[model samples]
Target: MTQETEAVAEEAFPQPGPQARTGRPPRRGRALAVLGLLGELLITLGLVLGLFVTYSLWWTDVLADRSAAAASDQLRDSWAAGGPAALPSGSPSGPAAQGDPNAPNAPGAPVPGGGPTSGAGGTGTALAAGTGVGFLHVPAMGRNYQVLIRMGTDADTLAEGVAGVYEQPYRAAMPWDASGNFALAAHRDGHGAKFHDLDALHKGDPIVVETRDKWYVYRVDSTLPETTKFDTGIVAPVPKGSGYTEPGRYITLTTCTPVYTSRYRMAVWGSLVRVDDMDAKRTPPAELRRG
Candidate 1:
């Protein structure tokens, strides 16, 4: 009876297949597994976001600082090798000398050929795109604050901590030029934050541009703390709303504002106060000297 009964029971159940014994995993176990997989995915996502933050905030600053320093050194060396003659001591007379009240020569001094002449030339020709044109010094920003001025204002051009001058619609007027707007742009944050402290500039602050042959001195006249990115009028020849009634020599510095964002732009305006020939020592004008 026992053997016959056992054989009948085994046939009915067949000891159950391995899958049936495992029974498609317990519902609780499946739920736990799913949660484990999701946790792993979240961990990986956190790592990626952390890396991105490090790259944007830290590595970018380091790379941009290095690039800017190299460009600044190269420009200084070029100026040292071949620069303009020292300003002659005396008064310069004539219409050419009228604009620059701070020229080395006195207001009524005898002038030769006109006013001061740049050894580089008086035409103030535009440099090739992306090439360095000069060095910009803003004493109000910092004592060591200076950046190479380049030809284009594109992102790549400004990423190297260089300011680019606008050349379209109206060409940038060199300091030697009789009159026109010299518009420049740089990044306000990241890329070394070249113009990060632009807000620090106050009226009467000096914005000095050093060319191969001369130093153009501009005094801050006004500032537009915030403006839309598309507002090209800020760089206009007459610079609408800039407090200028007539055409004249002007300098405009533009940068993104609000910090770490490109939503708007800030501008600092100045008018050319004087042009000084590069001295033998290539010394900066007294206006640019820090106390």
Candidate 2:
């Protein structure tokens, strides 16, 4: 085991020349190939996600707006044909639209747009889901800021890019109701985004509802920046925390808050300030006419 003998043994093995040549590929090569495949897959996935977002945020709005406009046209055509079902039962009489909103309700008093007047309720047949109710006008949104309203607020119903009446949590009153909250909801970003500009609304902003013959104009009274999604009280007969101490003709517009998310809700509340009779031309109210 001397130095001379050790050198002779190393020469016999030739030191393997740094590494023994092998026919099989290195493990690092296989790892790199797998990583390359993964990178390609990730790129494909990213493209798909971008397309989905575009569809959800942009394409859906175009399609929904078309559907809403067509539905609105059909509704107006029905009204022009004078279909009896076009208008709800009851007239703007008694404590419904003419009397004081806070006035004591007379027993069996007729309510506007009709349903059994609940407190400030009315008498009308329950409109089926997707039934077009009216057109909403928000001057603050824009001159052409109008969207059709339907009967139900379900996902399918709201998918048409139309505001829907609160028929589940509560039966929202008609636009002409004397003393009840006529609650409505629509998409905040996609699906026509009827309430996208809701945050731009302020106290005294005009929100008008166009019925077959009347224009119920409401002035934005207050707003709740954020609230729980399960807060059904916002659509109650007299919405709590809506700055309403008593019953009146109120309108509530709600949508998902913080933009493009439904984690919470934001509401803009308004009370009917006046009712204007629609003429043949169907001119908007003064507030709407303003720039």
Candidate 3:
């Protein structure tokens, strides 16, 4: 009776498979599962990195351009509200970017502070930080391309994509200055990329600045394709490496180099050539009108 009963039970129920006998998966199978999970995690990480790159390089430009345009509008509105007497910034003899009024103005230079500036307006006053000073027009960049000019170059200010007047060790000269360097900075790759084509500016290209009452016209004099980030002298009262040993009404434009990286800097230097008063039409200077 016992033998018959045992045989019947064995036949009815089979023993557990090899996995159950060892209480775990085979080592090879376990390794493959772990590898599959690792591959999935790596793919997820790659996708996240790709998304971040797109947002940083592309989406940021869109947001920055919008902010810059709004700021430009606000600045123009402020100037309009000020009226003729308010004089938000210096006079047009009509444009030195605003800075130390007394900075060295090379003798005989047409833009002296007194006794008939190159144009009509006088050196009126200084513009406050974060305040919109004017608009930058570079014909070489694009026929209609222009960016608002503000008074600060810090991250918070430049992030909005406007060209900022430097206020550090080398106080940037005003656009209407009798003499001195009117240096400016902006992002080249992102944040509106205000100065993206700065490198393309060749000697003699017009660089205009539109203020409340005047249009300051400048011509590119030189271009430094690459420089150290710490080279503050590039924006000095008389920018180094610009080949302009004499003091004069000069303008300096700076931005990051190598496309998307900020590891270095580039600069374009210009000198004021003329100033024109803005009539009722607010017509841009001839340089701006040309396609």
| Clash totals for all candidate models | 3, 9, 13
Q: Please, what is the whole-model Cα lDDT of each candidate in the order they appear? A: 0.74, 0.79, 0.78
Error of 2 at 99 (Å): 7.6
On TM-score, the leading prediction is 2
RMSD list, candidates in order? 6.7, 5.9, 6.1
Can you rank all candidates by lDDT, best first?
2, 3, 1
Model 1, 9-93: lDDT tens digits are: 8898698775688777578677989999999999999999999878876777789889978887876776677653222222113
Which residue runs does candidate 2 get wrong by more than 4 Å?
A: 1-25, 88-123
Q: Which candidate model has the greater TM-score, 2 or 3? A: 2
Residues 185-233 of candidate 2: C-alpha lDDT, one tens digit per residue: 9999888888988999999888988888878888999999999999988
- Residue ranges of candidate 3 with Cα displaced over 4 Å: 1-25, 82-124
Q: Distance (Å) between predicted and true CA of 263, model 3?
A: 0.4
Candidate order (TM-score): 2, 3, 1
What is the alpha-carbon RMSD of candidate 2 to the true structure? 5.9
- The Cα error of candidate 3 at residue 7, in Å, is 6.8
Show where candidate 1 strays beyond 4 Å. 1-36, 83-124
Give per-model TM-scores. 0.74, 0.83, 0.80
